[model samples]
Target chain A: MEEILSKLYYMTAFSSFTYQVAIMWFIAFLLLYLGIKKEYEPLLLVPIAFGVLLANFPGGEMGVVAAENIALEGGRYKNLFEIAHDHGIMNFLYYGLIKTGFLPPVIFMGVGALTDFGPMLRNLKLAMFGAAAQIGIFAVLLAAVLLGFTLKEAASLGIIGGADGPTAIYTTIKLAPHLLGPIAIAAYSYMALVPVIIPLVANLLMTKKEFEINMRQMDKEFPAKHTIKNIKAVKIIFPIVLGSVTAIFVPSSVPLLGMLLFGNLVKEIGVNTLRLSSAASGGIMNAATIFLGLTVGATMTSEVFLSPKTLGIIVGGFIAFAISIAGGIVAVKIYNLFAKKKINPLVGATGLSAVPMASRVANEMALKYDSTNHILQYCMASNISGVIGSAVAAGVLISFLS
Target chain B: MELFNEAVSIMIVGMLTVFFILFLIVGIGNLIIKLSNKYLPEEVVPVKATISSEPSNNTYAAIKAAIDIATKGKAQVTNITKL
Candidate 1:
């Protein structure tokens, strides 16, 4: 009877349960609630929250193991086969995909295929605001370094300001792998809150007159001197030329930006690369996202996530977000001071890589101030450029720090 | 202090590089638009010509009946013109 009771106890997880694990479960459940009930980036959050749940289960051995924990008696790391045999599946996926820094660029390929550069091409001048918004990244990097984080760790933390997940993950994996969980969480969570954040920051910086600046009316008054005649041909050539220029300037960013441009090229080519484009944006992208989210979530085991640093990242990330929006708005205000054709400051606020959501939010805010103000296309000009800007900024950080 | 200086240098360099690269793209993009416009302008497809003859009474009556049913007798068909 004593032997049987001991066996039963060993079978159950109750003996291995700890308060840290309980706390992790609460966090996981909170993420799940936000994903399901609140519909906050459910595609990513659902997979990630479920992964967190799997990792924190007592005696599961499913969470990603740290490199030190997995070190052999001889001070050598275990090979892939050995890791799979010992640490279950999540660690294997982590080492195979996420740690190798393979999936983020693959995801960027999908993003490129789905993106349209026509709006940006038409309104080329607005793209500068995208570059302006990247100030948040450097500003936060300086702040994080002042707060005692090493330059590498500060780079990873500050990249959450870029508002691009793949860029953030790619930089973090290279510079500070340990902080990947928190940085990625911060990046995606804030991206999901773009609708709320854009309005909040825009309200703070932009006045009622600025909000009511109608882009279409300005266009009518001051029409563009040069107009695109062969837009389709220009679209086909833009990605190739931009790719070459980016590769020349920032070779390090090619992994993410190059793949994005290639995806866009394949998408633009039409008929010939249709199958390839579809596979990239559809199957390959979905698989990479799943693995990326799961492995990222699995990295957030109790010992890693329950730290004062995570708190710092959360707060610093919000400041970065608010500052980036403000930076774009301020840039527009400065330009408005001199330019004859004034731009809507709301267009500047959409200068983050959240893409259409940021543009839509900015447009909605404009409509509230003036019913006829539709600036979605104008906002997209900067929004698309923001993707490139953030990627370039990430490359600059990697080149300098790593 | 060294770290702060490094951060500041990176900021200046990074922002400058980003602006330079994007500015180059804008310049090249405008050039492409101009060249394409002058050289490979959009090909205008010719529209098919339509006959100017009037519709027969049977066709006109059919059109009137269709509109009557579609509008639930609310709208009247004032005139029918052919191109």
Candidate 2:
């Protein structure tokens, strides 16, 4: 009886089953803290954290994954911490959504549903700003290649510069699934930090005169009697055309491009707002974000993040950011020359919308220059264009790399 | 020393790779547009405002419109809630 009892205890001790669940539970709490206390990208991050918590709970898909680490590299990196490259909740999320390119575009669809593209259409030059913002993507890609990342890995890392979450996640999964864990975490974290990051960079790049200079608001009257009859047709055309082009030129990017276009297709179809919004904003998008974030965060288990490779991603991302900003500024200068009226250079900053955060930052900076000066909405117009631009650049990069 | 050497190597090779790709894209994008104009169906007529009335774009327009609506003599008239 004593011997049997001892064996049972041993089996349970070796399992680490309860402990792994505890660890995931702790992670969930941390995500909640980040959401409630820190208020860091709460809408997306909170759900993500909870997903991590659930995934890690014993018998919750990730339990078996954590158990494997103890068997395999569990003892190899004794002194050093090890991030589970495979197995567990992170593994499931990665395989299901990130690898499949399922979630980000759906999230983007929701984003599209909520978005007003009016500003982007009005200022044709904001299209240039959107293009300009993509400089970071190339800059980072090159930097990654330089750091001895292969073409695919370089492409994956460089996409962080686009600062669009779904595109980065999708591209990385295609180009370098191994690096997805770090890249996704980095991409979303930087997006959350954009208000802090871009402001610092923007201020460093421009002077008070450049920032303060207010351009007169353009008279942007919505075209009267806009017909929806053909709007759906034109909308459908964008996805089909872009999707076909992407598949033909760069098949690797087809997943990202397809998902995005599908979202737009749903929007264009416009018959079922309920299903469209559900596909875009509801359970599917939310569940994926939750899964994407925690699983990504869980993947960051010490060893992976501490490497020289991570350093490469970090530095490469900033290189991308600076170059993208420079591209915007350069475009603005050239646009100013030919234009009859001088537009505010600050509008150039909205080329990357961490949603309204970057746009608002540009607006506030402008407000400081002239209290009555209001160009916040104009900056936002460019910001949305930047989101589209980032997605396109990612698609283009994936095409080239693949 | 090794890091510096690596950096120089990366810069040169990376710069070339970037331009090569960018050139191809710019070339292709323009080519497609030109080719389309030369070959494909006509009439995807975009908006017809030659000059942007204000230097700013839709962001400004939306804000200005909202403000105008907000500050109107009878601001209550533009009660958007009905929509």
TM-scores for every candidate against the unseen true structure: 0.92, 0.66
Give stretches of model 2 more than 4 Å off.
Answer: A1-32, A47-93, A217-254, A268-274, B1-83
lDDT of 2 at A252: 50
Q: TM-score of candidate 1's chain B against its reference? A: 0.59
Candidate 1 runs further than 4 Å off:
A69-77, B49-83
* Fnat for candidate 1 (0 to 1): 0.65
The Cα error of candidate 1 at residue A42, in Å, is 0.8
Report how far residue A322 has shifted in candidate 1, in Å. Answer: 0.8
User: How many steric clashes between backbone atoms does each model show?
Assistant: 0, 8
* Residue lDDT tens for model 1, A200-227: 8988888899988999999999999899
Question: Could you tell me the lDDT of residue A273 within candidate 2?
Answer: 59
Clashing pairs in 1: none
Name the lDDT value of residue A218 in candidate 1: 99
Best by DockQ: 1
Q: Cα RMSDs of all predictions?
A: 4.9, 12.2
